[model samples]
Every structure is written in structure tokens, then in C-alpha cells.
Target: MTQHRIRNKNLGLAELIAIALGGMVGGGIFTILGISVSMIGSLTPIAIVIGGLIAALAAYSYVKLGLYYRDEGATYSFFKKIYPNSHFSASAIGWFIIFGYISTLALYAYTFSSYAISSTDFANNIWIRKGIAIAVIGVFTLINIWSVNGMGKIEDLMVYTKLVVLTIISVVLMQHGTSSFGTFIDNMALDAEKSNIFSVLIVASLTFVAYEGFQLIINAVNEMTNPEKNIPRAIYSAISLAILIYVVISLGALFAIPTEEIIKNKEYALASGAGNVLGKLGTNLVILGAILATSSAISGTIFGASRQMSVIASDGYFPHWLAIRKNNSPQNAIVGMAVMASVLILIGGLELILEFGSITFLLVSLLMAVANFKIRDKTASSTFLTALSIVCLGIGAILILYYEFTTKWEQMMAIIILYLILAVGAWVYSKKNEMKGKSS
Candidate 1:
């Protein structure tokens, strides 16, 4: 007889939920607040709720597949194992997902930089901001590479603290609100009449990106306990809490701040809005929340994505050196991702990176839903819900593409070119593996 032990499984349900929340709560809400308000007006909260529902749909399949497979490689691992013979499928997903993580890594860091310096005199200095972004990414990378338990504890602290700060900020904003609840509802009704259903759905689709980080929970499967029970609980609970937080925050902003100001100071709308209503104290709280949100996001993104990248590399889908791990941590992969994200920060254009990240993740989530539907029976997923997830994600993907094409064709083209480059890289590596396997 052989004895087996699961060593160092330190993540409980709270930490698991924290990981999912930390991943989902980052720069997403801060970045999207202004954009969603600008597009949907008082209907911003409605769209956010819709977006969360869409996220739940996407999360359904992930929970099922994650529990079924329990692979730390997450999205890439699930696909690779499900379609073992199709190297291109594995390679393409690997490329899309890794780059998707890179884009988000850049997004969260860039958002962190924005809120970090918003109160300083050097706020408008692009160079200074980029430097801060790079520095933060470096700090989180070291934290991740140092110890998994350290990273988890830090993540739990950051996520919970940010939630507390955010709640305080939301309560303060509402207390000082200039507009009444009745007026807000009336305003929403007025805006709803002028807003098209398609446009609202598009905004919701764009918001799919904000819900991006919950899958980080799946990436930590190796360190977690009771995958069958915890995976679904953590993901679903996190998504539900995210929806509540986003809606409340949106309501707070809408009731207290004017639409024009939100549109004008889109980058730091909450901070600016708080400054007007609650003065410097209010502004400072909002800024604190944003910093904590983006910080945890950066740390969570690096922690989960690097592990997946190392797994992909070990399987020959990425550079071999990226596969190197020390003390159960992929140090090299974490540093590599941070370097690339830092470069993106220097490149600027936060909105571009945000949209690209959103689209990439949306597409990847859609694929996961499809994969789950294929194995619905094995995963014990609801057939109808799995099919619905597929349809909803598919719709969201198309809406984003349509919105990009109509509003920003040049940016859309750049995203397309980026995808093509990734596809080519995938083809090359996948072909190399195929040839090597045949030769053997």
C-alpha cells in the first residue's frame, strides 16, 4: 500500500473567495465607471448588473470545468486536455489567454499609476506615471516569486481591506449626494428612452472585462482544498459580491456626481466626484480604494497568470525558460510578464489596453463555455445553462467587435493584427511540438 498526502493546502473558503474577488475587483470598476456612465447614463447600474449576469454565465462553465479537471494551468490546461490531438487549439488558447493576462496586467498597473499620482503635482506627467506603474509591477512580482503562502495572505489582506475602504467611500458618497433617489430613477427613465437596447447590451459586453479576474481562483487549484465544493462557492460568491459592489458604487457615483464631470474626468471619476461632494477627505478615500483595488489586482494577476504561463511553457507552448520553477513558484515567468506589462505602461493609451484586455478575455471565456457544453454530462453541468452561457458569451463577443468596428476601426485593426501575430506564434510552436513528437 502507498500513502498519499496533500501538503500545504493552506487556502480555505475565505482565501479562495478573496482570490476571486481580488482578481475581479481590481482596476475594472474604476476604469469602467466613467465609460459605463458616459455610454449608459443613469442606466450605468443596470448595465453593470447585466454585465455581472453575463459574468455569472461565463463563470458557470469555468466552475464546472475547473472542478472536473482541477488543473492549475486553468484555461489552457482545460482546453489542451479536452482536445489533446488538436495542437492548434491548445496553442491558440495558450497565446490568447497569456496575452490576455498581459493586457490585464498592464491595465491594472496603469490604473494603479493613474490613481496613485492623481493627487500629486506630477499627475499629468506621463513619464512619472509610467515609472510608478513599472515599480508597482516589480514589487508585486517579487512578492509572488518569494512565497505562495506569503502571496495568499497578502492577497487576502488587500482584498478585504479594499472592500472595507470601498464600502466606506460608497456610504460617504451617498450620504453627501446632491441628487435624490427619486430624481435618479426619473433620470434613468429619461435616459432609457433615448438609449437603444443594443447600445446598452454593448456597454454590458464591454463590462465583461471588469469581471475578468474570478478565473484566477481556478489558477490556484493546486494550493486549494476540496475543489468540488470550494471552486463553485468561491467563484459564484465572488461574482455576486462583485455585482453588488459595482452596482452600489455606480449608484453612489450617479447620485452624487454630475454626468459631464464624470465624462470629463473619466480616468479618476470617483476621486474627482468625491472631491466635489465630500471635499479632500472624500477624494482621498476614493483614491485609497482605487489604489488598493489596482494593487491587489496586479498582485493577483501576476500570481495566477505566471503559473499558467509556466505550465504552457513546460508543455512546449511557450519559451522553455519560462517553465522554470523554484520552490513551487514560477519566478522567471512572473518577471517576464511584469517586464512586458511595464513596457505596455510606457506605451500609454490606457483605454486601448482596457478594451483589448476585455475583448481577449471575453473571447476566451466564450471558448471555455463551449468546451464545458461539450462535456456537460461529465462535469454535471446543466445542459440548458451551459447552452445559455455559450449564447450569452457569443453575443457579448460580437457586440464588442461591432462596437469597436463602428467606433474605433483603427484600434480594432490593431487588435486584429495582434491576434494574427499570436496565431502565427502558436502555429510555429505547435508545429515544432508536432514534428518533435513524430520524430520521437
Candidate 2:
């Protein structure tokens, strides 16, 4: 089949905002909050705020790169333009990001299925749940493939809806929450004394998952309107709003639910907390909100991952066929990402997917931070921010890697294996293409 070229266009502020918000608000907020509270007790809000700061630092690095590079491949292009020796490393890092995003899609798909079942009785049937999850992925893939613009609009709406839902829940819970100042102080006291510093670090790393969406804006920098300015604006705005929402929700849950219940039953703490404050309907509303949150995340993730493949293929790292666009969308990349994500859903399930994806994403953030440094040597501006970025990312990466090895060795290994395979695949493909060009 003849290959078609995929073109890039400038995306506007609104589009960038939609992509960032959509990417960031997924399954992590709805699900990870409960698990995080279990690990750090009432200090969960503090942990989330810390994670947000690290994420903001990383986002600043991207903004610096985005302003200088303004290329289609985002981090890949940034590293390639600034540190030619590390092109392969940058590409591999980008591949890890691709895998990370796909794994995120898998997690959201699973979460969507679980929430669907819990919200409605029909999801109890195993086959039904699997079918529904797969179908959701399929529908989202189709939407993205049909039109990137359409998907952008959908994501914009989803972001708004999720923010509103979470805000309402947080406000209600905060108003009705009954924890005494003494109880709050006591909970913090116990956490500080009983919990290991390392354990809090590990739990805090999970909160970083909530910050994942902001990077999605970078993937489509070429399509963004005035990316030089809007990219940073979108990143800062989305992350700031997300952090505020997370803190309120976390604090609300802490105050509304007993510490013992939250620690023991991490999976449904939010629902239980809502039930305590707002009754059955309140709990149901949170579930419905989760559905929106997960589904939006899943959809936005599919869009971002597919576009990454398209960008890579356009750069000649993959077969040109993968870059072919139909109706302003990368059809093959969309399908390929969907299939890979679906297989991961089947193999690792949701929990492993989240852990694996988080590890890969943390590593990529580190690479991007380094890329910022590499670029600063080439350009004179933004040196201070770039240096700050490197330090913050280095500290976060160390914490995340330490936690992964200690608490999640198996999933960390799985991420390593997958990354190696992608690296080798990219290398082999480049060599074969070089040979073909020589022969011709």
C-alpha cells in the first residue's frame, strides 16, 4: 500500500489545555487516593502536595524544551537536537514513555470495567466486564482515529466534567466531615512516628501518577496553537488545578472516614467516605464520577499514545506505514497502540500495569530533565529553571526507583524487559532501513 504523510499543525491554548487535563485526570485520582491514604495515613494530602511539586518541576523542564525546540517528537526531538550522542538513549526513553502511556491505558480500562461492575450489577459477570472494557477501548480508538479534533473536543468536556464532579464531592465531604482538630493532629502524630520515611516516599511516588496527564500536552506540541507560550501555560494551569483538587479530596476523605477503615480497606475508601457524609446517592455519584474520570483518561491516553507512535514513525524510526493518516488521524498507530494496550490488560491486569507504567514514566521524566540540561548548554536562557528541573527530577527518580525495587521488584523487571525489547527493535529497524537505502 502507498504510504500517506501525516502533517502537523499548530494547536491552540484550549486544545493544549484539554490534552493536559484529560491526560492527567484519569484512574489515578479515583483509585490511587485510597491506596495512598493506606500507606501514609492522614499525611496523604502532604504526600500528594509533594508529588505535585516534583511534577511541577518536571513540567517546567518540558516548558523550557518546548519553547526552544517546538518539534513534533517532543522529548525525542529535544534530546536529538541538543545531545546528538544520546539520540538512541532519548529515543529509548521516548519508547519507554510510549509503553508507560499504553500501560496507563490498560489500567484505566481495567478500572473502568471494575467501576462499571460495581456501579451496576451487570459487571459481575467476568466475561461481561472484559467485554465492556475492551469495547470501551475500541470505541475510544475509533473516535480518535476518526478525527483528532473530535477527540480533542471530547477530552475537553471530560476534563471539565471530572473537575466538577471531584469538586462537588470534595466540597460536600469537607462541609460534613467530622474529624476533630485533636484527631487530625493525633493521626499526623502517629504517621510521623510509626511510618518509615521510605514508606511515605513510596506512597508519594504513586501520587505522581495523578500528574501524568500534563505530559500529554508535550506529545502534541506540533499541533498546539502557539506552543511556545500555550504549552507552558496549559501545563502549569492543569497541574495547579489538579493539585488543588487532589489535596481537597484527600483531606476530605481523611476527615470523613475513620483512619482505621481507610487504612484497612484502601480500595473503596472514597466511596465509603462519601457514603458516610452523603448517603447512598452520594456514594453512587462518586462511582459515576469515577466512570467519567476513568473513561476520559482511557480515551485521552489512547489518543496520546497513538500520536507518539505517529510522531516516531514520521521520524523514520518505525515503518512509514504507521504514520499514514486517514481523516487527520494516525489510523495504524491508533490500532497498534490499542492492541498492545489490550494485550497488557489481559496479561498484567490493572495493578501491575499501574506499577510498571509508573516506573517507566518516572525514568522518562528523569531523561527529560537531563534533556533540559543538554539543551541549556546549547541555548543561554532558562539555565536556572533547567538546573532546578534536573535536581528535582533526580531526587524524585531516586525515590521512585528505590521504592519500586523494594516494594515492586517484579513489575520493575517487567518494565526493564519491555524497554530492552523496544530498544532492540528500534535499532534493528534503523539498520535495515539504512541497508535498503544503500541498496537502492
Candidate 3:
């Protein structure tokens, strides 16, 4: 006789939102504020809004595919299923998307260390920051390896608490303003007049990395209830909330803090701005918000990305060792990802890491858009939006590359070298898997 099995369905819409929000709202806003402000001044909010729109565009395809396939493996799984005949496609995407997640892991950890030490006596110590970043990655890796349920509950607490604290900080910053609202508006207008449309668009494109985590909801499809309804609701709701929160925070910073200060202290811009304008209490609030924000992000990234890695590994696209699990968790993959992120922190510069992450995700999301368009009928995705998404994402990818090539050619070369390395690695793995299959 055959036996049937039952699975737990405890997660609801709220927790799903928390997962998506926890992934998207981490160190992104904190890290991008200074870079955006430096490029576009007070018009940063406009660029942020555009970035959010791009994220929404990317989310549409993700949501459609998530519902159609309902796979926990997400990007890698989606592509593999769509192109099952191509080992190259599977291995390449597995490498690209996993590395993309690794970049984000580094991004969040670096931002966490920056804020964690921003108020300390050693705020400017580079080595200390990197050390702390690695330490936090270790902490979260253990948390993720320990228990999925524990990670989810902790993610909920951290994400929702950070949101409330961040909103309060924005309100307080607006109320205790140092700059006049009129001046802020005038500055935005002046910046808009001075900056080119292309620059604004490029910055918006780069900022797309900030919205990279919304697809994480799809990764938890097995744990969540009514995934068909909840996936769309959670993802869209999280992106909407993230856009509103980012806009309000950007506006508050522009009104209450000097643009120069924000650009100057880019690493800890929010806390720095709050410290200057709103005093110690304000600074403390910002610090707490940031710490919570990055904490949830690290935990969530490990939780989601490790699962994807394990899936890829099980298919022989990654090392077989990474497929090992304990208590139904991908503990080895989680630890491996954390270790790689730590290495990235030690060797990588902030701007290089940020740009690489943005470009990688933009490219990955663009691929996703293309994949969705190819199967729009089956996924029930609108062909028009999918086509539009491909165009926008493609343009964004080109603009980012153009901006990097024109200005930061060295970093572009490094990125190319990294891609080549990943390609070779993926090619080797794909060949190995093919050979093994033939032997079998």
C-alpha cells in the first residue's frame, strides 16, 4: 500500500509580506541613499520612485512564473524547467543567481557593520567594519542552519519592527527639520534642471538592486498557505510598501539633512544625518532601525538563497556536498554562502560590490523577464507587460554597463573577469553532470 503525506500550512499573507519586505528593505535604502544623492541630489526620491517602478515590472514576471510553477527553487528551477534540454542554461543561471545572492549577502552585511559601528569610537576603521560584517554573517548562518521556523519568526519580528521604527524616524526627521521645505523643493528643481535625464535613468537602473529580494516569497511556496493568491499579494504589497517607505525616508532626509552631509557619510548617512539634526535620541533610533533592517536581511537572504543553492546542487550544477541537509535545512549551503560573502567583504570595495550586485541582479531579472515572455501564455502573464519588462530591463542593463564603462572601466573589467570565471565553473559542472548522466 502507498501512503499519503500532509504538510504544514501555517504561513499566511502577513508572514509572506514579511519575507518579501525583509528581503527588499534591508541595507538597500541605507546603502543607496548616499550614492543616489551624490548622483542626483534632491531628485534622489524621483529616481527611487522610478527604481521602484522597475522593480514592479520585474516583479510581474516573477509573480506569474511563481504561480505557474510554484517552485521553491525560484530562478534556477524556473529556467531549468523551461529549458530542460540545456545543461548550460541550468548551470549558468545557477551560478549567476547564486552569486547574485552572494553579492546581496555581502551588501547587507557590509551595511550592517557600517551602521553597527557608526556611533562607536571606531566608526571609520575599515578593517573593523569588515570584521564585524563577517561576524554577523557567521551569526546569521548559524541561525539559518539551526531552524527554519525560528528564522521565520525572527524575520517577522525584525522586519515589522524595523518598518515601524523607520516610519517614526522619517516623521521625526520631517518634524525637526533643519532645512526649509521650500529650499528642499527648490534644490530638487535645480538638481533636476542641471542633471541629464540619462543620468537619472542610470541611477534608477542601478538602484534596482535595492529591490532585489521580492522574489524570495516564491522561495517559500512550500511553507506558505494558498500560494496562488498569497504570492501575488505578498510580493505586490511588499513592493508597494517598500516604495512608499523609501520615498518618505528620502523626502525626510532631503528636508532635514544637508545633501553634502548625506553624501559625505554615505556608509552611515541616515544615522549621521539624524545625529546632526535630531541629536543623540534621533541617531540612536536610526541606528536601531538599521541594525534590525540588516539583521532581518541577512537572515532572510541565507534562508532563501541556501534553499536555491541546495536545489541546484542536487541537480549536480553545484558541489554535491552543498546538497547535504540537517533537519530538512540546507545547512552546508548556508554555511558555504556565508563564508563566500565574508570573503567578498574582505577583498571587495563598497562601490565595486554595490555596482556588481546591481548589475548582476538587473541582468538576472532581465533574463527572468525574457524567460517569462517566452512562456507568457502558459504563465498567464500579459505579453505586453512582459515585453515591456524585457525592454526596460534591457535598457537598464545597457545603461548601467555604459555608465560603468565610461566612468569605472576598471570595475567593469573586474566584473567581466568574474563572469568569465563563473562561466568556466558552470561549464565544467555542466559537462561533469552530462558525463555522469551518460554513464548512468
Candidate 4:
């Protein structure tokens, strides 16, 4: 039997939960909720619930995979174990995951800037926002480099903060109710005359971004105390909690703000909704929460992305230098990912980066589900559950792609270009390493 020597001890259930929540509750919720409301009208809450259900299905599949395969690479290793001798395919999927993480980090970094400005009377200067964003990226990157555990603790706090803040806002909104519950419910009923099912599906696809971070738990299994049991528990718990929060928050926004205003000013919809109930102070609090949420996500994502890169390097698919860890942390890979994310932040703009990240994540998730099915016979799971996961993943991928083409083509194209460049670079680097190894 081949010994899998990678150490499996760093994180606990709390850490896993923090990572999951941090990854999912980023700036997207504050920014995308309004846009989703605009697209789906009064059905925003239901749409969020639907998105959560889909994410939950994916989360279930990931739990099984995490339990069966206790590897550091998570998605890549799971897929490779399922389809042996498919290193190229595994690495391809790995790159997709890496791209998603990096893109998300960039998006959140940019959002940090926007939220910072809104939270304070910061003159609303563009250069000031950019400077603040870069500074935030720099500070978090240092934190990630210094200690993963510290990053985990910070993430946990942010998760709780967001949940509490959103809950308070929801309660306040309910206290001063708008348009009776019956009206809201009636509005949820889709009108065939006004919008087709396809349109609703497209809009629903965008809402899925709010649930993206649920899977980050699977990647953190290597750090978990009792991964086999705790991993599944954390995935289910975190995902359920996120769903509840997302649904309540989306409903609160719809109830507080007019649909027309949400559509017209989609960017600060959460702030607008909070302002309706808590006045300007509520808006400021929401912006602060948004900043915390985005920053927490950036920290978690950078940590995870670096670990994935370390795994890829260890496999000899990339340079060995990237695999080196200082004080048990992949400092080089962390800095590398941070630098790349910073460049992306500067070049692509937040909206474009977010769209690209969402699509990449969707593709990787679908691949993981397919990989789950391929390994079902070999693993310790029922065929029915495995098949269900695959089906759900397929549906999700279709929805994401449909939404991208209809509404996010330019961003998708930008992502495609980035992937192409990464592919060529990875290949060239691999060849150079191979030659050096042969000579040595």
C-alpha cells in the first residue's frame, strides 16, 4: 500500500465553518442581492432559497468526496483518484479552481474599496478607493503569509459579524414592515406574461454566486481535526446557515426597497435596504459589514489557493519552489497568488472579475460532481446519492453557462483568456523543471 504522508491536522469544525461562511458571504451578497431582486422582482427571497438548495446539493457531494479522499488537493486529488492517469485533466480542473479563488480575491479586494468609501466620508475619490483596495490586499496578504490559523480566526469573527448584522437589519425591517407578507408572496409567483422561465433561470444563475463559498470547507479537510466526520458536519452546517441568512437578507431587501430602485442602483442595494429601516446609520453598518465580509473572503481564498498551488507543485506539475512552505505555510504561493490577484484587480474591474470567478467556480463544481459519480463504485457510498450529485452539478453548470452567455459574455471571455495564458505558462514551466531535473 502506498503511504499518503501529507499531514492531516490543523483545522477543527469551527475553522471549517469559518472558511465555508467566509467564502460564501463575501461582497457578492451585498452587491448581487439588489441586482438579483431587479431581475427576479419580488421572487428574490425564493430565488435565494433555490440557489441555496442547489448549493446544498453540491455541498453534499463534496462531503462524500472529502470523507472518502483525505488529500490536500481536495477537488483535484478527488478527481485524479477517481480517474487514474488523468493528471492533465486533474490539473486542468485544478487550474479552474485556482482561477476562481484568485478572481474572487480580486473581486472582494475591489469591493473592499467601494465599501470603505461608502462606510466613511472618504471623498468618493477613485484613486483613494484604489489605494485603499491595494492597502487592504497588502495587509491581508501579510496576514495569510504569517499564519493560516490567524486567518481562520479572523474569518470566524467576520462570519458571525455578518450574520448578526444582517439578522438585526432583517428584524428591524420586519418591525417596520412594507407591503404585507401576502403581497410579497403573491409577487413571488412568476408571471409568464412578463418573464419567461428561461429569463428567471438566467437571473437565478447569477444569484448562485451568493452561495459559492460553501465548498471551501472541502478544501480545508486536510486541516480538520477529524476530517472524516467533522468535514461532513461542517459542510452541512455551514451551508444550511448560509442559506437561512441569504433568504432572510434577500427578503428584507425586497421588502424594504422598491424593485425599480434596486434595478436602477444595483451596486449599493443592500445599503439602500438597510437605510430604509435603520436610516443612514444602518447603511453605514451594512457597508462596514460588506467590507468585513469581502476582506474575510479574500483572506480565506488566498490561503486555500496557495495550498492548492502547493499541491500542484508537489505533484511535479509545476515548479518545486511553489511547494516550499515556511513555518508550515506556503508563503511563496500565497504571495504569488496575491500578486496575481492584485494585477487582476487593477486590470479587469470588480464586476468582470466576479462574473469570471462565478463561471469558473460553476464549472469546477460540476466537474467535482461528475468525478463523484465516477468514483461511487470505488468509494463507500450509495449509487443513488452519487448519481443525484452528478445531476445537480450538471444542472448548475448549465444554468451558470446560460447566465454567462446572456449577460456576462465579456467577463467570461476575459476569464477564458486568463486560463489560456495560465495553461501555456504551466506547460512551459513544467518542461523547464523537467529539463533541470534531468540535468541535475
Write down the TM-score of every candidate. Answer: 0.97, 0.90, 0.95, 0.91
Q: Which is the winner by TM-score between candidate 3 and candidate 4?
A: 3
lDDT of 4 by residue, 1-440 (tens): 01221353657788888888888888877677666765667766666776777777777667778787776677777876787655556666766777778888888888888877775677477778777777888998898876667777887788788788877877676557576677777777644346666666655566677778776776665566777778888878887898888777777777777787777767687688778777998888877777778877877777777887888877776667888987667788888888888887667476766777777776677777777776666566667766775676677678777666767687677767878977776666556555766798
lDDT of candidate 3 over 1-440, digit per residue (tens): 01110254556788778878888888878668888898899888889999999999999999999999988899999999998999998999999889888988898888889889987898899999999999999998888776666777888899999999989888778878787778887887899899989989988987888888898888877777888799999999999999999988888788778888888877477777677777898899998999998998888888888889988999999999999976566789999999899999999676676676778889989999999998999998888999999999999999889988998899899888888899999999999999999999
| Residue range with the least summed lDDT across 10 consecutive positions in model 2 | 1-10
Arrange candidates by TM-score, descending. Answer: 1, 3, 4, 2
> Candidate 2, residues 1-440: lDDT per residue as tens digits?
11222354535677677677777877787566767776778878888888888899888777777777766567666766666654455556556677778888887887778777886778567777777778889989888877767777887787788779878987788778888657788889988887877777666776787898787787776465566678778899988988988888787788788877776656567787898888998888778777788878887777767777787777666778888877557789889888887887666456766777777777677778877776566544477877886776677778878877887788788767766788897676666555665798
Task: For each candidate in turn, give its C-alpha RMSD to the true structure in angstroms.
Answer: 1.8, 3.1, 2.0, 3.0
Candidate 1 lDDT by residue in tens digits, 1-440: 01111575767788888878888898778667888777879998889999999999999999988989888899999999888999988999998899888988888887788889888899999888889999999999989877777888998898999898888777777878888888988999999998989879999998888898899998888778888789999999999999999888888888888898887877577888788887999888888888888889898889889989999999998999999987677898999999989888887776776677888899999999999888899999999999999999999999999989999999988888888999999999999999989999
Off by over 4 Å in 4: 1-10, 119-123, 190-193, 429-440
| Displacement of the residue 236 alpha carbon in candidate 3, Å | 0.6
Per-residue error (Å), model 1, residue 374:
1.0
Clashing pairs in 3: none
Report the error of model 1 at residue 290, Å.
Answer: 0.6
Q: Which pairs in model 2 have colliding backbones?
A: 10-224, 11-223, 11-224, 11-225, 12-225, 23-213, 24-213
Candidate 2 deviant stretches above 4 angstroms: 1-11, 85-87, 196-199, 377-381, 433-440
Clashing pairs in 1: none
